[model samples]
Target: TIAAEGGGGWKEYAGGYSDWANYQASVHQAASDKAKVDVRPAARPVAAAAKAKGDKLSWKEQRELEALPERIAALETEQGQLTTLLEDPAIYQRDAKAAQQAAERLAAIDDELMELLERWETLESRAANQG
Candidate 1:
C-alpha cells in the first residue's frame, strides 16, 4: 500500500511495491512523452553553434566532435553504475578488492569525462573562431 498526499489531499494505492514501482515508472514515462511532444526540440548545442558559426572543422575534427557526446554518455553511465555499487555497503563486505577497483574506475571516469568536455569546448571555440 502506498499513501501519498497531494493537492487532492491523501490518496492510497492498493498494490505491492512492484506494482507501485511500475505505476510510478509509467507516470514518469507519460510525463516525459508529453514533454517531448509539447516542446520544440532544438539541435544539439555544439552542432547548432557549429552550424551557426559555419563549421570550419576538417571532416575528421567534425566526426570526432560528433562522436564525443556518445563517448561521454557511455562513460557517464558507467560512472553512475560504479558509484551505485560503491555506495552499497555490502559490496565492501563481499569483496574489498572489487570495491577498491570500482572506486578507482569511478575516479578515472571522472577525469576522462572532464577531459572530453574540455575537448568539446575547445573544439566548439575553434569552430566559432575560425568561422
Candidate 2:
C-alpha cells in the first residue's frame, strides 16, 4: 500500500503517481511562460550616456589609466622582495639588526602599495561612472 503520511507522499492522496506528476508539470510550464513574457530589451539612454562619457576622457587621464598596471606591478615586485627578506630565518639569526631593518622597509612598502591601490581604484571608478 502507498504511504501518504509525509511530504511528497501527496501522490497517494492525489489519487496516484500520474496525477501528482501532471500537477507539478503544469505548474512548471506556467512559470516558464510567465518568465518569457516578462523579458525586456536593454534601455537605450543609459547605453548612449556610457558611450559619450568614454569619449570624453582627457589625454593625461587616459595615459595615467594605461600606466597604472605597470606601476602597480613594479611596486608589488619590490614588496615581494622585502617580504622574503623579512621571512628569512638566516637573516634573523645571522643579523638581527638587518632583519629589523627589513621589517621596517616592508612596512613602508606595504603602506605605499595600499596608497597606490586606492588611487588605482579611484581612477577606475571615475572612468566607470563617466561611461
Candidate 3:
C-alpha cells in the first residue's frame, strides 16, 4: 500500500532541534548564576585593634566620661547664678552699684569656667586616643 510517488515508503518525520536549544538555555542560565569571590587587603592590626579596644572602653575611660559630667556642671553653674541675679528686684533696683560689682565677678568666674572646660575637653580627647 505505497503511493505512486513512494510517499508511504518513508515514514513522515518531524525535524526538530528542541533538545539542543534546551541544553544551551540551561548552560547560559548556569553561567549567569555563577558565584563571585574576591580577595581584598586586610585592615591594619595596630589601628584595628586600637579601634576595637576603644569601642569596648575601660576603667580609665569610665573615669574620663564621669569627668565630663563634672565639667558640664561646673561650667554652667554661673548660668544658674545669673538667673538668680537677674530675677532679684532688690539687687536690680536699690543695689544697682553692688549688682554691677557682682556682675563683674560673675563674668570672671565665667571666663575661668570656659578655660577649665576647654582643658577638660582636651584631656577627654587624649584619653579617647589612648584606647
Best by lDDT: 1
Instruction: Please give, for residues 1-131, the per-residue lDDT of candidate 3 as tens digits.
Output: 11122654532111224533443354345434332221213425633664666544567656766776677686477667764774464664576567655555555566557655764665567567667
Candidate 1 local Cα displacement, residue 15, angstroms: 33
Each candidate structure's count of clashing pairs: 0, 1, 0
Candidate ranking (TM-score, best to worst): 1, 2, 3
Give a tens-digit lDDT track for model 1, residues 1-131. 54465676754443466645554565466556555665434436856776676648878888988999999999999998987886565675688678666766666687679778987887878778877
What TM-score does candidate 1 get on C-alpha atoms? 0.56
Looking at model 2, residue 87 earns an lDDT score of: 46
Better by lDDT, candidate 3 or 2: 2
Candidate 3 residue pairs in clash (backbone atoms < 3 Å): none
Q: Which candidate order results from sorting by lDDT in descending order?
A: 1, 2, 3
How do the residues 1-131 of candidate 2 rate in per-residue lDDT, one tens digit apiece? 14454675532222346644543465456556545774435435644564666645567767878898898899789878976764454664577577556655665566567766866775677778768
Scored by lDDT, model 1 comes in at 0.70
Q: Regarding lDDT, does 1 or 2 come out ahead?
A: 1
lDDT per model, in order? Answer: 0.70, 0.61, 0.53
For candidate 2, list the clashing residue pairs, or say none.
50-131
Question: Clashing residue pairs, candidate 1?
Answer: none
Per-residue lDDT for 42 in model 3?
46
Model 3 per-residue lDDT at 68: 69
